[model samples]
Target: MKSTVEHLSPTRVRINVEVPFDELKPDFDRAYKKIAQQVRIPGFRPGKAPARILEARIGRAPVLDEVVNAAIPAKYQEAVVASDDVTPIGRPEIEVTEIADHERLTFTAEVDVRPEFELPELEGLTVEVDETEIGEDEVTEQLDQLRARFGTLAGVERAAQKGDYVQIDLSAAVDGTAIEEATTTGFSYEVGQGGLIDGIDEALEGMSADEEKTFTSTLVAGEYADREAEVTVKVTTVKERHLPDADDEFAQLASEFDTLDELTESLRERIGQSKRMEQAGQARDRLLEKLVEGTEVPLPESVVQAEVDSRAHDAVHAFDHDEDKFAEFLATQDKTREQFDAETREEAEKNVRYRLVLDALADREEISVGDQELTERILFQAQQYGMAPEQFVQQIQQAGQLGVIYQDVRRSKALIQAVRAATVTLPGGEVVDLSDLLGDDDADETVEEVPGEVVAESAEDVDGDAADDADTAEDKADAKA
Candidate 1:
């Protein structure tokens, strides 16, 4: 067998392959066995007919097609691996150019390969992120919410206010188009929860029982229409919060803390930790956005397609091939499968651009993943997946997904290095504290987000990589961790 590659472009190649008569023998024999099983010959058992006899019955073209089709993928894969080029993401379009049943086989496949790009700028670019300092008021507010969680609900004799829980039968119409028909009977929604329909919560803020009011509000756009809907909300009941007594006994009942003061102190610590984490999130997002903007690079089609395939594969895998999630996802959006596919492709394109930009920065600055850092990051991520570290490491090695792993490590290290080189400023014009951007207290919540499909290790997902490592030695460390 001989294979020669013709360069179509930096990211495209046409590999002209020639399989000689000797190499075609194995495939010819195998193809006969496969075809023999599918058809019956007179005076012969199925799959037991001689190759020559079956070929005489079926003619040579059909048998040759079977052999070529069956053997092309394996042959192409070998040729691809042997080539001195970067990896290919999507499957190739295979076509048989020439073939002879016992002579030679030839074909071509047009594939999408990773693009070539120069490193982008990633120096002292700046971004403004919200602060992490937990003011006394913020601490108190968190403490109050915690206290309220343990408190009992009670009926209020007064008018409904902001902090009250109301049970109401709500209905709405849009030029006689009823959309708010969705029932929430005995629905327990927190009044100030902004996640509910916009402006609907404010309408019930001060209303009393049995009071009905018709107000027009626009539906949240995008999936929901932007048109206005006139809603008639009737407040059936309004109940106020009855907080627990902020005393020693109550504190003991609510937590392991001995006294109300101890509980408050613990809450303060937790709240501070939470605030630090929140700021860390903002800091990370700001940093990523800045990194993307700082660098200017064009993304390749493979990069985007690779991400799209990854997402689709994960979604199907997560459902264990149930297929209902795919249907439901599209149905909810009032879209078909084609539209969803396009959306995935678009998302993949953004992901590719972001990844390329970050990588260019890493390369330009000579930043790289250390061996020790890689091992630790892998082990930590394995634990997150609830697997043993050794097992996870073995799996990563087996699947050849280590390139993806190394890229993640390089990006993270590069970002951290940039942070060290940068000078940050806060909104009040004071020099912002850079501490929160690097580390936070809730080490567990810092699970990483890798595009919309893969999750890598970061502050949010510090242990995410461990999840990928699900094998034996890995499982042991994972169990211990």
Candidate 2:
């Protein structure tokens, strides 16, 4: 067996391979064994028929066809492995070039390969991040959030207002035809939360208990999705939350602190810490944008197209792949199909660019993700999806997404290394050291005290948040993979 690679472009390669008949003994044996089980012979039991006898019964063409099909993939992989510099990013397009009866088989494969590029000097690459600012108002807002968590809901004998929670019965109709699925009774919703049906919040405000209002709203789902309909809502009850006073007794009840002053001070410190962490996230984002924009990486067209195709598949997947329905959905967002496509292409290009740049950096720097970091990232993703670690692993495995996770972990670690090497400037022109936020050399204490539910979300949430464009492709590609 022999192989040679042709450099078609900076990011692609064509490999020519020739496998002599003697080298295909194993593949031929497997193919014959498989064919023998499917054919009947006078003297031989199933899967025990000799290869010659089976070929005589089924024709040599069928046997050769099976052998070629089975051998091409493994041979292509071998050719790739033999070419030390070739690293394929996607599946190869294999074409069988020739077959000499029982002498040799020849084939060619074209694939997208990672481009060889030089990494920019990591040290001294400067980027600006938002200044960390924790004002008294911000601290007070945190305190209010904490108090709201402990607040009690009480019945209010007045028209509903913003911040009030209400239980309501809702029904909708299109052209006077009632839609049963859109009707719900006793649904509890906050007046200004704004995640429910459109126009619902506006219709709910100023409505007293037992009072009803009929308004127009666009249906977001079901058969009438993206269609306008008239919705009638009746308020069953309105409740206003009564927050505890921000006093010493309340502080003792709500927190580990002993007094209100202590609690306020803790809130201020927590808020300041969160602000700094947010700055770290901004720094990561700015750094990534800078790396992607500043570097002139030659992206593989196939990779970018794969991303674009995956995104397009997902965009219309909700509409059952019906282009007309997707167009309708886009129309509801005031977006033309052309506009959506343009935006998707731009995002896909950025994603491919980011992945290529980071991968190159990772190689040049010999960056590697530790077992602990990989597991932590997996756990964080599972938590994000509300799945247990084992379940998430199984799901990604079934979807062939585990490799994407591995790549994400690697890219994130590589970016962190770059962050540490780069100079991050704050708004006031002070150089911010991200050593603590990005963690120490061993990275055992990478976790920072980010306020509120952010900590529970993920210790590295800030690091990955700013790279969402790249990370989103990883997530979506898992489905495509």
Candidate 3:
């Protein structure tokens, strides 16, 4: 058996293979054994018939066909393994060029493979991060939030206000046809919270208790989604929250701190920590943006198209594969199908490019993900999906996505390495210390910021958002059904 590779393109290759008949003994033996089990002769028991007898009983053509079918995939994989440089990313198109009876077998396989590219140095990348400043306004806002948590609700006689909690009965109909799923009684909603039907907040603001108002809003999650429906909301009762004054007593009641001054100071420290974390996230985003813009990573059209097709399928799957209904749903977002598809393709290309770049960097740097890191990521994802780790793992395995999760974790680790190698600076000319965030506590270590402020971007942000949109759309479709 022999194999040779032809460089069809930077991202594709063709492999030519030749297998002599003498080398196909194992294939013939396996084929004959399999055929013997399937075809039973009167004189011979199953598994005892000779290969020639089996071939004579069935046609020699059938045996040859089975051997060819079984041998192609196994031989193609062997050829791929023999040529280590060809890292195939998609299925190959195989054609048997010649089959000289009992003499030799020849074939060619064309496949899309990962493109060979040079990796850029990550150490010289610099990016700008927002200055972490905990101000009085931020602290006050935190204190206000804490106060609101401990506030008491009292029944009010006036019109419902923005902060007031209201008890209401809501019903809706589209074209005079009642939507049972859209009707609810004695529902408690806060004015201006803004998550319910679109116009509920505006309609509730000036309505007094026992007052009813009818408004038109688009239903988003049910059978009536993307359709305007007339909704009638009747205010049963309004209750205004009365917050305690920001005094020592209130501080003692709200937190572990007994003094309002102590509580405020703690709040400021917490806010500062949160801001620093935000700064770290921004720095990472900026670093990625710089790397993506500065690096010239060749994109594989096949891989990009695969991602685009997957994203588009997931998007329209929620409408029961109805393109027109999906277009209507897009119209609600002020998007047309053409525009949505264009954006999807662009995002898919960016995501594919980032993945390839990160993978190359990981390989060049010899970065590897450990079992603990992979398990931790799995656990985090489980929590996000509100599932137990074991159940999530099972689901991922069922979907054949365990490799995908591993790749994602590896890519994230590679991005982390890039971030560590990058220099981050603030507008005040002070270099920000990201050691705590990066888990490197050495104060003397200096990561020079990028020469200019660069925005960091993540492939996960693009792909994850696409996934979330698909999940949400599917959930809505299920609920409507």
What's the ranking of the predictions by lDDT, best on top? 2, 3, 1
lDDT of model 3, residue 351: 76
Residue-wise lDDT of candidate 2 within 70-98, one digit each (tens)?
Answer: 77766765676667677767556667899
User: Of the candidates numbered 2 and 3, which has the greater lDDT value?
Assistant: 2
- The global C-alpha lDDT for each of the candidates, from Candidate 1 onward, is 0.64, 0.78, 0.75
Query: What shift in Å separates residue 56 of candidate 2 from its native position after superposition?
Result: 1.9
Q: TM-score, each model?
A: 0.64, 0.89, 0.86
Quote the positional error of residue 359 for candidate 1 in Å: 6.9
Q: Model 2 clash tally?
A: 0
Which 10-residue window in model 3 sums to the lowest lDDT? 453-462
Q: Summarize candidate 3's per-residue lDDT along 53-118 as a digit string, tens digits.
A: 887788788887777776766676567666757666554567889988799889997766667687
Using TM-score as the measure, the top candidate is: 2
Q: Between candidates 2 and 3, which one is better according to TM-score?
A: 2
Off by over 4 Å in 2: 332-334, 444-481
Best by lDDT: 2
Instruction: Report the poorest 10 consecutive residues by lDDT, candidate 1.
Output: 457-466
